[model samples]
Target: MYILLILAAITAINLGKAFGTEKSITGKSEYALAVDVRVSVPSSAFSCMKKYGYKTVFVRGYDPTGDGKFDSNAVDNIHNANKAGLGTEVFMTPQPRSDKKGSQQLVELYEGLKNGDIKVKTIWVQVTSPVNWFPDTKINIDFLNDILSAAAHYEVKIGLYTNGYDWSQITNNAAADKIMLW
Candidate 1:
């Protein structure tokens, strides 16, 4: 009877291992490591990243140049990352002094993503550069709100990428509670 019980326990353990439940039993985290890149990289790089256990990559999607346009390599990088079996996300650096409004910039980004047939859950807005924002907190707040509204208009989410000091300087930490921080 004791031999039969031992055999049954061993079988259960093997079954769990086969079903990939050993990690849960071992208390191993299922979360993935992520990296953000501003420039375009080749597929081989992404493959290397995956082999090294990077599960997600955030690629820059917007170019804050004259009039502000989508980054030329954003779509291709996203596709490459996906093909390499890594989860992909996009971030945009907005130019406050550009001719385009915040909403217009977001429109360009959204349309670009749509045209590329790329889907992203959220577009993280980088607000780290102090020179990119106005000195008046109210204007900065309005600019962020415009982007937020644009995100909502397209049924997409928005996240902020800023440190505490930059956040305080930019919008006085306004709307901090409304969006996810990265």
Candidate 2:
């Protein structure tokens, strides 16, 4: 009877292993991590991101200072994300200037020798600030159009992120295929 019980226990263990439940026995779980970074990843978060098997990351590309200076956000995150073996994407936000000059600045930033050269998996343009401050559909649309043009000039595809209400009224649903919900 004891021999039979031992054999049953062994079989159950083997079955669990075969079914891939062994990780639970060791308190480990499979993780596929993806994250977004607004400014910086704090450097320390890189290890955490790697621990979770981070494969993709969205890092703010530039702060778009009208003074022709891009923030170190993209540069900082790009290095850390690369060290952590994470794929990097760029999110470019306009500065206080949300008009033609803003788009021109966006293009210049993304096309910068340092900023433009980074390997961005995709470019995501934030629509909130533009809509909130600009308020006029034409202004925002022109902003987007210029952004789209600049992105095209760089040969990068753009992904738009925004909440699905008033901002949507500006971005519109016809662009559903390109919208990414956060």
Candidate 3:
């Protein structure tokens, strides 16, 4: 009876191991460490990374402006990542600079870079789905150009963050610089 019990236990353990439950037992690295530098991750993510030896984490949605001017929430995020010893890459979302609101956002962008440390090695232009489509190709190009020019002037490199087609469209000629090429 004891032998049968031991065998069942061993089989159960093996099955768990096969299904990756062993990671929980061994506390091994399950996910690659990356800091998004955005708003913040949920408690579950924090707990998992804490359990595993995750050397890097990504923080996302950081607002550059403290008053929510451009990205008001980003300043705290940058500080948070720095405190946590994670490298930060600021993802700049595209906003229309043709209007007052957008112009304010641009100012916020400039302020984000200026006030923050030079640790932001890569600037990703967030052109993801829904917000992915530009009013006109020129609109996107012009916005990207402005950001790139700002980054270049600030001694930071710019990278285009987009799906394959959009990225291809931007990189064909005058748009090529230091693309983050996602």
Instruction: Identify the candidate with maximal TM-score.
Output: 1
- Write one digit per residue (lDDT tens) for candidate 2, span 11-119: 1232213445555565334444467675566555766666766666767666655543465666777787778777666766665343446567666556552543565
TM-score for candidate 1: 0.80
Cα-based lDDT at residue 90, candidate 1? 86
- lDDT per model, in order? 0.79, 0.58, 0.49
lDDT of 2 at 159: 72
Worst 10 residues of 1 by lDDT: 1-10
Better of 2 and 3 by TM-score: 2
How big is the positional error of residue 146 in model 3, measured in Å on the Cα after superposition?
A: 1.3
Among these predicted structures, which one has the highest lDDT? 1
Candidate 2's displacement at residue 145, Å, is: 0.4
Off by over 4 Å in 3: 1-31, 35-37, 40-51, 60-69, 97-107, 116-119, 130-132, 166-175
**Lowest-scoring 10 consecutive residues by lDDT in candidate 2?**
1-10
Candidate 1 lDDT for residue 82: 93
lDDT value for model 3: 0.49
39 Cα displacement, candidate 2 (Å):
3.1
Which pairs clash (backbone N, Cα, C closer than 3 Å) in model 2? none
RMSD of each: 13.9, 15.0, 14.5
